[model samples]
Target: MEISLEKPIQQEVSVTNTGDLSEIQRVLTELLYVPDDKLKLVVVLELLDYFKEKFSQKDYKINFFYTKQNGNITGFVVSQIDKEYRSYGMKCPTFGWLTSKDFLSCKLLMGECEDFVRKHKFRKIRGPINFPKISGGIGYQTEGFEAPMLNGVAFNEPSSKVLEYLQELGYKKDAKYSCVEVVESNWNKGNNLDDDIVLKFLHPHEIRELRSQILTLAQNSFYSVLADAPGGQSRFEEMMDSYDLVFGNRFVIKDNFDPRSISSIPEFIEAWESCDLNKIVPCCPLAYDRTNGELVGIIMALPNLFQLWSKEPLTHLNVDTVIINKEYAGRGIFSSLQNVGQITSRLHGFEYVEGTTIYANNDRAISTIFPHSTPLRTHYVVQKRILRK
Candidate 1:
């Protein structure tokens, strides 16, 4: 029951699929504390379903590493086969790591990780995925902590110790991303878009029908950068559901009309000094290929603040996603989207807008987003032994 790296990892420890839901909820609530009770339940339900699938199949594993004597759960993770491994005809499959909590020993956790890697003879361990790439993607926020709350924007922030452990085990940056912030200003305007591209707002009722269009564009937009990587359609689909649960209108945050609109950072801070975050306003705009009637770009935004009820205030809005088809890149499509987001957010009285996640090594995306916003925080998608020698 008690697993120690100091002991023989094989005999003293074992990885099992009997991860009870109650135990997981305890660990998640204790360590993660995803703020909203409803959201937390949703997350738990999702995790339960995720573990069920992984454990039921012989080809899968939902790893729960614990102390054998007391049956105390100390570490947890999950993984499954990936398309890349199957396509490559490799014996070492790509497994998406699930989660680990508590102040579990770095050596103990890493030993389990290596064990999982070896058992499946996995080519690499792609992780931090909420579950599988088909449902979610990999990520760990590394900055702007202390919100102590979670909503549709960013979920639970993992402990710095997790990153430390991964680094010690020689885990490399499989993907690096940042949540950039853009203060409300006149500079990043919507006029930057190409003349032929027309921006249209998504009707609340249009989500189901438009999901396909958006998905197609999203797939095309992310293919070069994240097609082989995690967090694509699955991530977007999850966000769509979040839009219904967290945001009032099922598409936008409610109307934002605070009389004390912040004009400067100092003003914003002053407003933050005494304010209650009540009003919410979000904008979801899409750019269509005027020539072919095809959807090519999208920009989704929402009113957001860490620690929802804190003095933090809703001065800043979160840009959930910005995707433009690859064939449409470098055409000011993204810039135009940013501009529109800024204008819409500013009009709603938000002093700023931010993106919670965007890959760091994606120079094209970084360059495109840089002109419209400033990087506020960094998050890493840590991975190891994916590509074989």
Candidate 2:
């Protein structure tokens, strides 16, 4: 799996989906190669572990496609059809984890993906969507290369050349994602929510206990907002698995394991142990209807753990997701949530908050959610219609 740094020649490449861990690991490690970046190395390891786990599952159809030029692995991509994944139709494979040494390698790897899609009789192929959305976030970094890499999102070298290669190979943009950063002081202080809607920030210890309630709020809010769009109902339904993964596993650690002990990564351990739960407040504020105590709005953000690996003081936050029930949309809950989040973050020494992964065309979120925030980075998930249905 040794990758050559020398110039790649235009040669015929062979593709295979061996699902071999050691080979897959070497390919990913070399592809994601960044000098002296242990954090990125750890990320690669985590992604490998995720693949190892998913590959063992009987319910998933996971393929690891790699290209070989004169028997040397030049590039690789992952394609999968999981019951829970539905960016494309269930029968279509979502392709991701793409890397290539050059244009020819990219074409070979993606050609294998198209072959897989057509053999299975799927109408269209969609992605660059690396699943769980949090890990190696969906798509290639087609824009905002100047933006600093943040925790909980994808980061690839600017010289990777995968995006342009895909475009040249005739893949169209399936979806576009953008992130925005707002200085604490610049955040607008909108009118407070009505007296009937109560806003509260959860204590770190209580997050596990209220996890179910929070998940319910997220589900109800997302469904109401998304169910009206084309294929939105199914997409929302499919996204519940991601919601469960976040709230049930990633956000709230199990009661049995020490939270710090759960992660083998030293930086993550340091980040977790450094938190003085009482003093360092997380800005996960929830708005509830006072009349019936129904959760109506939520704004979630967490400390940027990657800052530790960068040898910087933890002064940044990643605003992951914000959801408000349609029933509660116009009452300033969204603005109030952001305002509260800004104050909480500022009080706890966070200087900046980046609202990330917002859909590019979501005008409501772009215009209203973080109005004062400036653009940070952008990503694009690509697709090609393999069959003329």
Candidate 1 residue-wise lDDT, 135-190, digit = tens: 23346667756432333333434444666667776777666667766643444434
Model 2 per-residue lDDT tens digits across residues 1-389: 99889896756788877777888777776666442366767667767777887888877677888888876778888877655454422344778768788898898888878877877777677777665444456567756777656655556667788888888998888778888877444233344447677766555445445556665665565533331111223233333333332232232233353534433433223333444433324466667787998878877675665565567776777777677887887777888777665654554567878887787667788877556777878888777888533
Superposed by TM-score, candidate 1 places the C-alpha of residue 13 at a distance from the truth, in angstroms, of 6.0
Cα-based TM-score, every candidate: 0.68, 0.77
Model 1 ranges with Cα > 4 A deviation: 1-16, 30-73, 81-105, 113-121, 131-137, 146-159, 227-229, 246-282, 302-316, 346-352, 386-389
List per-prediction Cα lDDT, in the order shown. Answer: 0.53, 0.65
- Model 2 residue 228 CA deviation (Å) reads 15
Candidate 2 residue spans exceeding 4 A from truth: 1-11, 33-36, 88-92, 119-121, 184-189, 209-213, 223-281, 309-312
